[model samples]
Target: MIMRPPGKSARALLAATLLAPALATAQDAQGQNVTLELNAVEQVDEACRISFLIQNGHDTDIAQAVYEAVLFDTEGRVDRMTLFDFGALPAARPRVRQFVVPGMACTALGRLLINGADTCTGDGVAPDACVRDLTLRSRAEGVEVMG
Candidate 1:
């Protein structure tokens, strides 16, 4: 049997199929926002270990991402304020970072507030890129996360 060229509709379909992924990737890079989720909190030794799952959806990798965080006690009083340094977050990737607060217990915490991004530096990244369109989430029970 001799092979023949594909018809117009078939060619169009093939082209669309080939370009769909690239188009979707472009759209995703343009519309995606950084997501930070409070993944877990547990007691480790005499300290409280807090975990964060952060997804970098931008097109550039983050060399250093630091956020000012405030921890509140169960009575709504400010327990502590510190900076969480999530180093080297690649684009379109999710990273988990853990911090241990000495002499603190997980059960004593009521809420974690992300005050702002102290530093978000990377190639092709804006000064406020990390916090401008950030989406916050929490999966830890008995603790609330807020921007």
Candidate 2:
């Protein structure tokens, strides 16, 4: 029966616990999943005015924000980004930031203005009863260019 001193064992356990989080972060960074994030953004004048803040989607990920306003000239298609200042995300907390990135054209972004908390409104007990309205903002003033 080789019993270690209780104090020593407790210190070792505490040290492990403290280092666990950092080790976990390193593991996640080495993962293969390339996660992209669009926290939040304010569109000024529907075009020509967009501040950008981008992250790699990890809790402490760092990334550069780049959004060339020229992704809509191709066949009038435009890619859009949504904003959710309120409400949390699935399996994570809600994060908000401003960003502009070269997007795929002809995209529609929806922001639940009023009912952003639930974001679930298939409340139709019958075939179709509940109806919700989302602010669908289409990409505007983007040229046919991508980078």
Which structure among the candidates has the greatest lDDT? 1
Question: Which residue ranges in model 1 land beyond 4 Å of their true spot?
Answer: 1-30
Collision pairs in model 1: none
Per-residue accuracy of model 2 over 2-110 as CA lDDT, tens digit each: 9976698899998999999998887565442112232233444443223222222222222222222222323444334344232222222223444343332123332
Best by TM-score: 1
Q: What is the C-alpha RMSD of each candidate to the true structure, in Å?
A: 4.7, 14.9
Q: Residue-wise lDDT of candidate 1 within 39-140, one digit each (tens)?
A: 999999999999999988887898899999999999999999999998888998889999999999999999999999999998888988889878998999
TM-scores, in order shown?
Answer: 0.82, 0.26
* Count of residue pairs whose backbone atoms collide, per candidate: 0, 13
Q: Candidates' lDDT values, in order?
A: 0.92, 0.32
Model 2 clash number: 13
